[model samples]
Target: MTKVQTAKDVIEQTKFFHRKLADFYDNLSDNVEKERVKILLEYMSRHHENLAAILDDYESEISERVLDTWFMFVNKKCDLSPFFSASINPDMTAQQVIEIAVDFDQCLLDTYEGILQNEISDEVRDVFRGLLEMEKNEKIKLAKNALKIDSM
Candidate 1:
């Protein structure tokens, strides 16, 4: 995606990130042999799709003034370097995949948190605060599901 300058740009970037992550999980599911891991990856892939849909809703409903407002670029820059540098193979265990997925969720949550800390308007804060809550709740749900999977 292009540079993150406005609120709408950030939403677009986040949507792009979710879509790419879903694709990654889908690819991993196809390459893996374990049925359980495949199912989990598929679930995660669907989860990302849901996130992207939420962003779409936000993009449509966001106030014009807020959408045009510029935001900080430091945290808006999503670095998937750690994820990209690693070697993901068919041999990778389900637990390892779960761990990675959890990390990805945490990173998204952290991004929203960083934005909240920056000096933005109340309108922007309210929008991001809602997103932050959703992210936080999703992380917890994912962790619970991961634990169940780990026990299997």
Candidate 2:
């Protein structure tokens, strides 16, 4: 509640970190790796439920341009995966690629928490909190299905 950072600042941080996470996934080269990234992306897409809540809380006076930018950031981040590179093609072992992705995901989650924990807004914080926890859970989910992905 310190009112140090503006809601705009909170919005921007979340936006920046979200894209970074997508780009991080988009950087992987191997086939298995891409699948891992894809899985993460799909997991993220499931987040619409939480994100809608935050978006609803934005000021009525805010311009659609701001919302558009934020939405694009979300869309890009949730859908990104580096495995699209025709060269990389995701061939690594499931265990290996997912581990790397998880590290970056953790960083993404931490950045989100750091920015969101501030007094910016509970609406914003709630979404970040869900994302942070989901990133942690994703590692486990991938691990559980490692063999399935590896065989593919």
Candidate 3:
């Protein structure tokens, strides 16, 4: 049976997801030969790490009632396996890395959107809505910064 998850559970899982993405970028940065790609990977790694930290703070501030609000219908979609298993190599270009980063961000955006679709209390909904907005803004910022990096 699929596990029913609370808002806290989802937040924790997403925090872990960001940390894993950061680690993935860090590991790739170490092996890449191109300076531009390494710089982009390092930037992406820091972005994810920052995002995870923000989530950690968010989790600490949210009330237990909202955090404990369970969602029976929301399907878990935070799987990072495909990203981890993808055939990313040390020879990839900065553009290629940005594309992968965008894809990863899109996956996270979709996950939040999916969670927001289920019936939820207003407080829980507001929490997710805030998270969704943050994800959207971050994705846009990432794209813009990555483009500047690629142009250099």
Best by lDDT: 3
Which residues of candidate 3, in runs, are more than 4 Å off? 1-3, 76-82
Q: Write the per-residue lDDT of candidate 2 for residues 7-122, one digit (tens) a residue.
A: 45555555555555445444443233455555643443333223434434543445544333221122113222433332344555445555555554555555555655454445
- Cα lDDT of model 3 overall? 0.86
Candidate 3 is scored at a TM of 0.91
Q: Model 2, residue 66: displacement in angstroms?
A: 11
Query: Could you give candidate 1's per-residue lDDT for residues 1-152 as a string of tens digits?
Result: 22347877767878988898899898888988877788788888898899899889877898899989987745655556646864677777788888787767777877887778888999999988988898788778877876676567
Model 2 score (lDDT) = 0.47
lDDT of each: 0.80, 0.47, 0.86
Screening candidate 3 with a backbone cut-off below 3 angstroms (N, C-alpha, C), the clashing residue pairs are: none
After superposition, candidate 1 runs with Cα above 4 Å error: 1-4, 76-79
- TM-scores, each model vs. reference: 0.87, 0.40, 0.91
TM-score for predicted model 1 compared with the true structure? 0.87
Give per-candidate clash totals.
0, 8, 0
